[model samples]
Target: MDTSASSSQVAAAAVAVAMALLVPILSAAAGGDGWEDAHATFYGDETGGETMQGACGYGDLFQQGYGLETTALSVALFNEGWSCGGCYELLCHDSTYCAPGGATVRVTATNLCPANYSKPNENWCNPPLRHFDLSKPMFLRLVTDFRAGIIPVTYRRVPCAKRGGIRFEMKGNQWWVGVLVFNVAGAGDVKAMAVKGSQDGQWADMSRNWGQIWNGDKRHVGQGLSFRVVASDGRALVLDDVVPPAWAFGQSFEASGQF
Candidate 1:
């Protein structure tokens, strides 16, 4: 890891923070067109060790393709874990620490910043307040001072831009089929996933097992499988024959559908 910051790096960061403060950014949660108020702080060091495995079940963040571009959503925004993979755009609104050049960061909501019941009054993640626990790199990209532990910010939900198609990691067996869905673009959160076997007469709803994984009862062995993915926007995309009849547990399947 590079332990030293070059002069150019510092100057660039200062400019970005300054611009972030001056920009009048308007954004959305997919419905509204205006940026909302929020507070932000940073966690973990340059290694990002503490930021890796999180509450969202997005195990191995970098291995899953989300590098330092991630944040932990406070209680107000986590939506009880359903907002796990949602994306947001944020910038420092106004702060003494802010330095020119609007610097906005698009980050995936990878974890939950749980409310501290013991210190509700002091906890930024307490209910009714919108906050973000950003990774150190992302925070430094906006503010130069690590001492500026917290800063006022404006944020809005944005579509996640993923490179590949949706990937489903198969888990469990035929009797209790569980699949972990990831790499989703657009409205990244999955409201529900309906699975149908080639031999089945109708689609079977899969309940949230944990995080992004969904499970369903019944066996679909030796049957070509189809999936109906319903994203947070309430839109559904049916991937025909997403899995082969010989599909087995522990295998990942990728389908060319974006939502």
Candidate 2:
């Protein structure tokens, strides 16, 4: 028997099993309901730009952009954008930096804080897992002083609240149909989407292009669009006949229900 090769295979299998075990623990740490202790710092204006966009395909939340509030999470909190669009309520606990009453603010996860993005000492996600790099305006809302650079915070995930109902943006034409979902409420991020054409009477799975967009090549024009959205938490919502038969490019349709 090749003892060395057998040992190598066993080592590889052990590593794989270890990785599988770590996944659930990490996921729970990132997405669990329990409030977690974390650190917070602010970005934008003081750092440089007023306008910014995130890897999750969202524009700036501070000034004029997509009109959504923005919050950048540490690499740990970002979870590779799996936490995109998710809302979080953060409460400041540092008596020196934060007010005595412990002010709280709710913000949406819009971006990732990579290691190279900031100074080595300021890299929040490196060793410590839970961290938030909030927008300057957001951070100020929870603290009494702007001079204090970072503060201790307790944060928990919350359902997103959108002003309008869920909006569907059409990108493709008759032959190929591409739709971008927006203003998702509960669970925020989309895991999967299925589209049904009025004529076909069958559900067709749409491929995730990235972020909130999904596409499938099928003649769907002149056919009313029905959508089934699966949120990141696996909760599914079906909006029957959400898109009208005369749907046009660049037009957005609102669904009666949000996910």
Candidate 3:
């Protein structure tokens, strides 16, 4: 339903290769052998009102197909905002409100659970503390009681399992290009991005602007587009001619395959 991306930033994306093989190297596993301790709370109602927009730069969550299966990560797990789009599996733990032997919920990291310095000790999202601020629906799936407010939980990183191909939404103007990368699979978090225009056939390196958005300096109007995307684990995907020559800013494009 929607789109955006990252850098591997502050440096150039020097590993991009055009016409590379389709092979995707298995990502280095970030998931742990056992669950890690964490805490969770719910935000927004069942309609997911407040959960729609986020710090991840993602647009309408439902329109982007993220729906309610999304969460805001504590600063510790947010990886300085690069963790946007990463997937996590969570299970209720050691809480009376937990659903008995319930299946774990898998959610994407779509926002940041900011720490309140004024209430440092009371802030679960403070640095060095792993926490999840989940959508009300997602949190209720784990806890039997919505009134519990917060619940102890365990979680682990997991390969994202997105349906269909990865999506890209073009943002910004002709002077600069901002792309929002979403619906990613595999390592979920993008490490680097490069774009090419049919007219020039030259790749322009993009830097992590913020959240899941990447920015580049070149202008490629009225040209077919290709993309080079690298995941956090070093795997890469090359999408050739995914956007037509007539593509315009704000239009979303889907590549043929995923990483």
Candidate 4:
């Protein structure tokens, strides 16, 4: 398996969760819920295809399906210091699937992967979906090599209406992700932000703390980051389990970790 790609996928997954957190703040400012940004679909159950179950929002619907589809893929609280390397199967289009000895092959779909692409609708099941077991808890960042033509299908986010008091896992940390995104094309700035507090398993209250990562500059136009929870209450936060958020966006190049 391509460790770099797998790692990138893991990292990008975190940012996707983080990106979902930005949708509400952006939508509230825009005075409307922004679900028309692109033609995308979310899936819950996995048989190696991105199927739509006709649900609204992003990750929330997907998580619901996952719980019913596969126990390993279900949403739960990851304990601190849980470690194990496991393998799972998934289907993809155009991407090569190979595993080295002792390597865990995790076939997944990122916001940038084509296998997870789907038409925009209120369905919970759609195309371009993936299924697998999360081996560890860590915030992941993904950066695609667009130069190689591995472009993301489109930008996506979780609907704010669904993210109230819900938590998800990313970058090895558990967090209540907000569904939102930033528009750099018109605004010319997409700054990275973080949710504060140990309010695990709870929705983020916007009237709280936010840490800025970037300030919409030329460097971050086509790039993004996801900050995972590393330290909470002055101790390193251990991720034994995590729940996926209600929604999130996909990306090409991604990274994971806490700031």
lDDT of 1 at 232: 93
| Candidate 2: worst-modelled 10 consecutive residues by lDDT | 59-68
lDDT of each residue in 1-259, candidate 2, tens digit only? 9999999999999999999977644443354447678988888754425526666655434332234246778877777666777889887764477765455788877777666545667577664468888878778887888778888877888888876577787876656667877778887888888999888889999887755668854588778999998988899999999988888876778999875
lDDT digits (tens) for residues 1-259 of candidate 1: 4536677788899999977764444332222356888899989997778898788777678867788999999998998889988999887867878534657899999988889989978999999999999999899877768789999888888899987788777778646777888888888899999888898857988889777888855477678788899999888899888888887887778898877
Provide the RMSD of all predictions against the true structure, rounded to 1 decimal. Answer: 9.8, 14.2, 16.2, 22.8
C-alpha lDDT score of every prediction, in listed order: 0.83, 0.75, 0.84, 0.24
Query: Local error of candidate 1 at 150, Å?
Result: 1.1
* Candidate 3 lDDT by residue in tens digits, 110-205: 999998989988999999999999999999898878998988887878899888899998888858878899999999999899999898999888
Cα-based TM-score, every candidate: 0.82, 0.72, 0.85, 0.17
For 33-88, candidate 4 gives per-residue lDDT tens digits of: 53122121223223323332211112332442221221122111111101000112
| Pick by lDDT: 2 or 4, better one | 2
Top candidate by lDDT? 3
Give me the runs in candidate 3 sitting further than 4 Å from their true place. 1-32
How far off is model 3, as Cα RMSD? Answer: 16.2
Residue 49, candidate 4: alpha-carbon lDDT: 37
Candidate 4 has what TM-score? 0.17
Query: How many clashes show up per model?
Result: 6, 0, 4, 64
